[model samples]
Target chain A: MSFINYSSREINCKIVYYGPGLCGKTTNLQYVYRKTNPDQKGKLISLATETERTLFFDFLPLALGDIKGFKVRFHLYTVPGQVFYAASRKLILKGVDGVVFVADSQIERMEANMESLDDLKINLAEQGYDLDKLPYTVQFNKRDLPNVAPVENMNKLLNPRNIPCFEAVAVTGPGVFETLKNVAKQVLVELKKHY
Target chain B: MSGSDLVMYEEEFGKIDEELQRLYIQTNAKVVFLVDKNGQLIASAGETHDIDTTSLASLTAGNIAATGGIARLLGEKEFTILFHEGEKDNIHISLIGQRIILVVIFDSRSSLGLVRLRVKKVSEALTRIFNDIAAKSEREKSEGKIDESPFAEISDEDIDNLFR
Candidate 1:
């Protein structure tokens, strides 16, 4: 969902980066936080365990400039991807306007990717959102890894819907901005259609 | 936009601001703000210049969500209020209409009891205002009176310009 403050002339949208454990969801956020201008970004808050694994979520607020007179702001969030953190994941999905599923591309993590996607769909449904109707995308992360699956195979297995998918190494920031921009555009287009 | 999306117009914004201003003054608060459950800063009052309210809004929502989750585990509906005390300043957080958060930051000049008493009245006023806002939004939406989006004429190039 998006919040349009007519009095303030601003629009706010929430986007969630989701994937399995250690799939570089946080890495993607860290890369964006590092690259974005200070005026364009807010503090990156990570509620993680003592070992540095995300326990609740990581939030980063980015100002994506103005569309016409309304200043557009996107609040980016990443859920804790560990399987047992199902409750936390559901909480973070509330009022989400867009999603980026950061799938790990290593061959051994295929099952994890599949499960995480299924989890996303189910959680969205529970919250009365149809993933098919939202501005959603997929990213095949960790492309730099040696044992990665073929892009075509990953696509066939993961992205049957073929909604814009990118191959990315989130740590070094190859396709991070591309993925972010695609989803942000889709969100803006959706806003145009709605109003 | 869906029914759940928040649309704040000038009329209700003024009303909310008045209530927040009253709360800030009555409670002697350093700052008082309202944030949606989605972490959007709806409105704020008092001394906000030294604070990063954008970050504060996000973290406050996250705090509520985490606590709400804990509430579910214990078979509770939701935790309606949360308070934190520090050496010098204190924070009093409560849910308004189950969709918005009311946060009050104060120092030793005010006591917890006084803050709570004033918050109770302010919360009631804020909830009524939000209900009215929701009804107005729904009426406008159904009657096709909602303003046309500024992005109606947006192009791919226009979007790309933001990245630049």
Candidate 2:
């Protein structure tokens, strides 16, 4: 859901980064937080377990430059990617305006990616959001790893609909901003339809 | 993300802001803010000038989300209220109207009982206002009164300009 506060002249949207465990969802958010100017960003809160793994979710509020005088803010969130955290994932997707699926680009994690994608579909359906209709993108993350699967193969499996897809090395920040910008654009376009 | 849009006009915003201001004075809390289930800050009052309500709203929503998940696992429909006691300050979070979360932060000058008492009453009032706002938005949509031209006026160039 996009929040348009005419009183404050502000537009707020919720974008959730979702994928299997260790797919670099949180890393994508951390990179965005580090790169964003302090004045344009807020505190990044990670509700992680003792081992630094996300327990519930990681949230980062970012203020983009105004769009035609209305301040545009995107609240970025990452759900716990572990399979056991299915409940948490559903909760995080409650009012999401957009989604970025960070698929692990490794041969071993391909099955995890598929499971997580199925999980995403099921969860979104429960929330009355069709995965096919939502403003969504895919980032084949961990591209720097030598043992990663080919982009063509991953794309075929993860992105059958052929939505915007990017190769990302989230830790080193490659394709991170591109991914964020494209997702944010899609979200705004979606908002335009309703506004 | 569900297919729902949160529309807030100046009129409803004023009503909500006024209620929050009342709650702040009635409870003497450090700050009181309303956050949507999606983490958007709807309104805030009290001593929030120096605080980052944006971050506060996001974190509070996440907190409520986690707590709500716990409630579900325990076979509960939802956990309506959560109170976090800190050394210097405390936080009271109430999930009202199932779509809004009311958060109150205060220090030792106020007791939990008083804050909870005040919050219970305020939550009901807020719930009513939000209900009316939702209804009005739906009516606008049905009547084709929503101004969608602004969205049409937004070009790709305009979107690209923001990143640059």
Candidate 3:
């Protein structure tokens, strides 16, 4: 859901990053925060458990330039990747306008990724959002790792619907903004119809 | 804005932030933030950056929202305070004005009574600020000029830079 501020001529949409634990969701956000100009981004918030694992979520508000007469603002959020944090994940998904599913590109974590993807679909369905209809994308992260799953294989398994999947090495910032820009574009396009 | 709608007494929020800072220090809490029940950050004190305040504000707001839903189901008009004691830290979530939430995070050293005492007074001040905020937004939506911006003509390059 977007809050269109006619006074400021700004359109604010919330985009959530949904993925399994440690699939570089936070890293992607941290990369964006580091690369963004000071004036255009807000503080990055990470709520981690005692071991520094993301317990709830990490949120970053981004001003994604203006389109037509509206200043486009995207609130990026990442759900805790751990499976037991399903309730927190659902809460974060509320009012989300778009999503970027960051999949861990390792063969060992394939099942976790699949489970998380299933959970994502189920939660989105509960909220009246059909994943196929929503502005959504996928990022196969940690591509640089040696034991990572082959891009072709991962895409075959995850991107069967062919929804803009990117190969990302989030720690090094590769493919991060590409993933974000594509999502932002799709979200804004979705908003254009309503305005 | 109408007289009731425009609370001229709203500028007292800065003073409240200072008071919150004092409470944050006295309680030895690492971070203390105030946000509307809608999840907009009002003011913050103590380690705002060292920890993830953006996520904290939203999560704190989410906590209140979920519990508020439960409260509504139970036929309660409001939910006052909720405490979650974790392994190494604790979060104290309190609802204010049915429109704002006050959250304080502390280590093992802080007590529930101390955080609540501060939230009780802070919420009173914050409630006034949020009401004024709501009033101002309503007024702007009615009075401000609404039109498309020239940035709608932004070049593809400019749009590309935004994601970077």
Candidate 4:
């Protein structure tokens, strides 16, 4: 959901970074936080558990350039990727305007990637959103690893919908913002359609 | 809504800013901002003005959200007001006419009655502007232009370069 401030001429939207454990969702954010100009970003809030699993979520508020005359701001969030943290995932998805499914591309993790995508669909369905219909995209992360599934194979298996998919090594910052921008753009377009 | 109706670009900020300045002094509230439930800030006035108004705007909406949960537990259709008494300062949150949030941060001196009465009037004025903004946003979104932003054309290499 987005809020438009007639007083200041600004528009704000919420975007979520979602995926399974070790899929580089948090890494994607950390990379953005490091790269973003301090003036254009907010405090990167991470609520991780004692053992270091994301306890609740991570939040990063960013200012994209203005659209027309309205300032477009995005609040980026990432849910705990662990399967046991299902409840927290649902909470974070509330009012989500867009979703980035960061799929781990290492060959060994293909099962986790597929299962996580399935989980995302189920959770979204519970909240009245469908992965296929919603403004969503996929990033095949860990592309730098030799064990990584070929982008073609990953796309065929996970993103058959052809909803924009990207090749990325999130740890190295590849395809992070492109992924964000794609989903954000799609969300804005979807919002525009409704308007 | 045409650019002419934009109070920010057309209306003299001095007038509204001064109005907010006076309200801040009279109320002695630490933070005061008028925002729709959708989390858009209309006008902000208060002392201790160094706060991050942007995040404060969103955080105020979050507070309202948590309160929505509270209202559900109470078995009501919705909640109109919420008060939180902290150690040094107390927070008074009220829904102004069901459209905007009237938030007042004050210490002990300002009586509850005073805040309530002031909020009643502010809420009425805010509700109209907020409703207009909402309607306009609805119009824009329905037009489906958000997908056309240039940023959407970015590629994997562009995102990778961002990290540098």
Candidate 5:
């Protein structure tokens, strides 16, 4: 859910990065955190296990430019993608304004990617949100891996709805900004409807 | 947790801010804030100069959400109150209408009993105010007063300018 505070002239929206474990969901947020200037970003907090696997979530608050004189702030979050963290995943999806499904593009991880996608739909439905109607996009990450699936194959599997798709090597920051821009744009447009 | 975005108008904000100020003073709390279940900072008051209210709001919501999840697993409908104690400060969080959370951060000077007592009374007032705001927004939507063109002036180029 986006919070439009007319008194503060600030609009805050939450965007979630979702995918299977090791699909570069956290990497995407780190790239954005590193690139964002100090003034435009808040502290990045990661709740993770001892070995660095995400335990609950990773949160980053970023300020985008003004839209019609109102400062636009986006709270970027990443859900723990391990199947055992299903409950934490559901909590992260609550009140999400937009989602970037970062599918693992490695050939061997396709099933995991599909399972995560199904989980996303189920969690969203449990919260009364329809995946078909929510602002969504897909990112085929790990594109630099040698055994990655072809874009066409990944598209056919994940983007049957043909939502904007980007090939991202998130660790190197390629396609990260593009994916973020699209999701933020869609969120802003969605907010316009309620304005 | 609903899919709809939260729109706080000037009128609604004024009322909430006033109440937060009153609550802060009445209970001698160091800080008090209201947050949506989604972790959005709605309104806040008191000794927040050194606080990162935004981050606090987000983490508090997560904390409450995790608590709620545990409640469901135990077959409870909800756990409406939570308290975290520290050496210098303590936080009390309670649900208002199960949609918004009220958090009171107090130091050693104030007792938890006082904070909870004040919050119980104020929560009733907040619930009514929120209900009225929701009703007003719904009525406006049906009357076609909800304009969609406020964002027409924002272009894709404007958005791109942020990353650059």
Candidate 6:
């Protein structure tokens, strides 16, 4: 659910980065926070446990330049990837305009990736949003790891919809911006359709 | 809590800003702001220059969401009000119309009872204003009068320019 403030001439959209535990959802946000210009980004907040695992979520507000006259701001959030944090993930998904599934590309984590995707779909449905109708994309993260699954196989299993999947190494920042840009573009286009 | 997007026009925003300003002065708050459930800052008043309101709005919403989750497990409908006290400052958060959040930041100069009393009055005013706005937006949307989105003409080049 985007918020269009005609008085302020601004548009705000929420995007959630979701995946299984240690699949680099926080890494994706950290990379963006580090690379974004100071004026373009706000504080990167992480509500994590003592060992640094995300407990609630990680929030990074980015001000992408104006589209026409409206200042386009995107609030990027990452859910706590641990399975016990399902309630927290559902809370973070409220009013989301788009999603980036940061799937771990390692061959051994295939089950985790599949389960996370199923959870995403179910949670979205519970909130009256169909994953098929929402502006969404997938990122195959950890491509730098040697034991990664083939992109084709990952796409076949995870992305049956074939909606703009990217190969990414989120920690080092390859394909990070690409994934964000694609999803943001799709969200803006969807906003256009609504009006 | 509605599924549709929130569209704030100039008129409704003016009314909301006025209410916030009144609340700010009445409660002697350091800053008062309105945030939608999605954590978008709607309007703010008082001394906000030194604060990072964007981050505050996000965290506040997350806090409310977590509290609401806990309320459900205990078989409660929702915990609509939350207060947090620090060494020198305190925060009073309340839900308005269950769709917007009213956040007041104050210090020892104002007591919680005073803040709560003023907030109740302001919340009533805000709820009426928001209800009117929601109805007006729905009417405009259904009548096809709300079709002035600038993205209608946005090109691929325009979006790529943001990254540059």
> Model 4: per-residue lDDT, tens digit, A1-195?
565444566767778898889788888989989988997798777778877677767778887665656667788888889999776676676667788999998888889888888988888887677777778889988888888777888888898878788888888887987888788777766655443
Q: What is the DockQ of each candidate?
A: 0.70, 0.70, 0.14, 0.14, 0.63, 0.69
Best by TM-score: 6
Q: What's the TM for chain B in candidate 1?
A: 0.95
What is the lDDT of every predicted structure here? 0.93, 0.90, 0.76, 0.71, 0.90, 0.93
For residues A45-99, write the lDDT of model 2, one tens digit per residue.
Answer: 8999999999988889888888878898999999999988888789899888889
**Docking outcome class, model 5:** medium
Docking class of 2: medium
For all predicted structures, in order, the TM-scores are: 0.97, 0.96, 0.66, 0.73, 0.96, 0.98
Whichever of 2 and 6 has more lDDT, that candidate is: 6
Q: Sort the candidates on TM-score, descending order.
A: 6, 1, 5, 2, 4, 3
lDDT of 1 by residue, B8-27 (tens): 99999999999999999999
Lowest lDDT 10-residue stretch of candidate 1 chain A: A186-195
- Fraction of true A-B contacts recovered by candidate 1: 0.71
Interface RMSD of 3: 8.6
Cα lDDT of model 5 by residue, B19-71, tens digit: 99999999999999999999999999999999999889999999999999999
lDDT of 5 at B161: 74
Better of 5 and 6 by lDDT: 6
- Writing each residue's lDDT as its tens digit, candidate 5 over A41-74 gives 9989999999899999999999977877889899
lDDT measured at residue A60 in model 4 versus the true structure, 0 to 100: 82
Please give the range of 10 consecutive residues that has the lowest summed lDDT in model 6 chain B: B144-153
lDDT of 2 at B89: 94
For model 2, fnat equals 0.77
